[model samples]
Target: MDWVVKFARSSIGAKAVVALTGAGLVGFVVAHLLGNLQLFAGPEQFNNYAHGLKSLGPLLWAARLGLLGMFVLHIGMAIRLQSMNKAARPVSYQSKKAQASTLASRSMLLGGVTLLLFVLFHLAHYTLGVVDPQFLEYKTAEGWHDAYKMTVIGFQSAPVAGLYIAAMAGLAMHLGHGVSSMFQTLGLNHPRYRPLIRGIGPALAALIFLGFVSIPIAVQLGIISLQGGA
Candidate 1:
C-alpha cells in the first residue's frame, strides 16, 4: 500500500522497524546464550541439545531464515536512518561535542560492522564447518554430532578464543546503547522510569557478554575440555 511504503520511508518508521527488529535479535541472543550454556553440563547433555535442535529439520531452517530476515532488516534500516540523518544536515558542524552521547552510541556503526564480521566468521567456524572441517567429523558414541568436542577443541587456539572475547566485548558495548535506544524509540522511556530503563540496557549487556565469553574462557582455563572435567 502507498501508506505502508510512505511510513517505511519515513525516519520515524525506520527507527521503529530498527527497534522492533533489534528486540527480536536480542531475544535470539538470549536464547542462543542459554543453549550455549549447556556446555557446562558436559558432552552428553550438550550433544543431545544440539541433536534435538537438528532433529527439527525444516523447523530449524525456518527459524534460521526468520532470524536472517530480521538481521538484514535491522542492519538495512539502521544504515538508511544514518544516511537520512546525514542528508538532513549536509553541512558539517563547526565543532562537535559529545555532551549527551556515550562512546558506545558514537561508535555504533563501527561496532555493528565488527559484529557483522564476527558473525560471519562464527558461522564459518562452527556452522558451516569451513574453518575446521575435522570438527564436524567428530561424533559422539551415540553418533550424534560431537558439538561439545568441537567447541572445546575449536577454542583451544588462543587466537580464536581471543577473537571471540573481543567480539563479545564489542557486542556488549553495542547492546549497552542499542537496548536503551530501542526502549526510548518505542516510547517506553517515561520520566518516572527512565533511569531504570536505561540501566536495564547496560545490565543486560554485561550479563550477555559474560554468558557468551564464559565458554571460551572456560575452555582456555581447562575447566571445560574433552577430558570430561566440565
Candidate 2:
C-alpha cells in the first residue's frame, strides 16, 4: 500500500500516466480523422458511417467514457507535473536560456488549456449542437442524423471556420510537443532513432491539423456543399 501510494505520488509515475494517455488520444485523433474523411465521399457514405457508430449503442458509450477518463487523467497529471516543476524552481534564473526546449514545448500549458477549451467548444458545436441551431434537429431523407449537412453548415460560416483553423494551430503545436515527449517519458528514445522519433511528433501533428482543417476550408470554399450531398 505504501509503495502504491508512493508510486502514485511520484513525478515519474505522473509522467508515465501522461504518456500512456497521450498515446490513447493520438490513436483517437487518427481514427476520428479517418472516420470524418468519409465526408468527402458523399452524404450517404458519411451518414452511414455515423449511423454505424450510433449503432454501436452501448459500445459507443463505453468508448466515450473511456476517452473521457483518459482526458481527465492526462489533464490532471499534466497540471500536477507543471505545478511541481514551478514549485521546484521558485526563483527565476538571472540569465535563462533554453537550449533544448522548443516554442511548442514551452507553450505546452497554454496549448493544452487552449485545446481543452477547443474540444469542449467542438463537442458543443457538433456533438450537442448547442452552439448552432442548424446543427440541431436535422435528419436525412433516410431518417438518419444528417451529419454531413450539419458539418457543412457548421463550417460554412467564415467565423466558425476561422475559429476552427486557429484552434487547430494550437492543437498542432500541443501535439507536436506532447507526442515527442511520450517516447522520452516511456524510455523509448534511442540515440540511433532519435532523429526519427523527434520528427514524428511535428509530422503527426501537421497531418492531423491538415486533415481536420481541410473539411472546414473545403466547406468555406464551396468545394463541399449541402446541396451537393456533402
Candidate 3:
C-alpha cells in the first residue's frame, strides 16, 4: 500500500500513465475519424454503418463505457501532473528560452482544456442529441438513425461548423505535442532517431485534423449531402 501510494504520487508514474493513455487515445481518434468518414459515402451507406454499430448492443455500450473510462483517466492524470509541475516550479524563470520546446508543447494545458470542452459539446450534439433539437428526430427510411442527414443538418450552420473546425485546431495542437511527448515519457528517445520520432506527432496531428475538419467543411460547402451525388 505504501509503495502504491508512493508510485501514484511520483512524477515518473504520472508520466507513464499519461504516455499509455495518450497512445490509446491517439488510436481511438484515428478509428473514430475513419468511422465518421462514412459521411462521404452518402445516406444509406452511412446509416447502415451506424446500424451495424447499434446492432452490437452490449458490445457497443461496453466499448463506449471503456472509452469513457480511458478519457476520465487520461484527463485526470494530465491535470494532476500539470498541477505537480506547477507546484514544483512555484516561480517562473525570469528569462525562459524558447530553444527546444515548440508552441504546441507550451500550450498543452490550453489545448487539452479546449479539446475537453469540444468533446462535451460534440457528445451533446451527436451522442446525446441535446444540443440541437432539429437533428434529434432524424431517421432513415429503413428506421435506422439518419446519422448522415443529422451530420448534414448539424454542420449546415456556419457557427457550428466554425466552432467544430476551431476545436479540431486545438485537438491538433494537443496531439502534435502529446504524441512525441508520450514517446519520450516511455523512454523511446534515441538520439539517432529523435527527429523522426518527434516528426511523427505533428504528421499524425495534421492528418487527423484534416480528416475531422474535412467533414464539417464538406457539409458546409454542400460537397456532401444526405442523398447520393453531392
Question: Against the true structure, whose lDDT is highest?
Answer: 1
lDDT of candidate 3 over 132-171, digit per residue (tens): 7767688788877788888888998899999999999999
Report the C-alpha lDDT of model 2 over 1-230, residue by residue, as the tens digit. Answer: 89866876789988998999999999998999999888888888899999999999999999999999999999998888878777887775444344245344568888888999999999999999889876768899988889988998888889999999999999998999889889889998989989998999999999999999988888888888886644
lDDT of candidates 1 onward, in order: 0.91, 0.88, 0.85
Score candidate 1 by TM-score against the native: 0.95
Q: Highest TM-score, which number?
A: 1
Candidate with more favorable, higher TM-score: 2 or 3 = 2
Comparing 1 and 3 by lDDT, which wins? 1
Model 1 misplaced regions, further than 4 Å: 94-105
- Would you list the rank order by lDDT, best first? 1, 2, 3
Off by more than 4 A, model 3: 1-5, 98-106
Worst 10 residues of 2 by lDDT: 95-104
Ranking the candidates on TM-score from highest down gives: 1, 2, 3
Candidate 1, residues 50-139, lDDT tens digits: the string is 999999999999999999999999999999998897798777655446324534455888778889999999999999899999988999
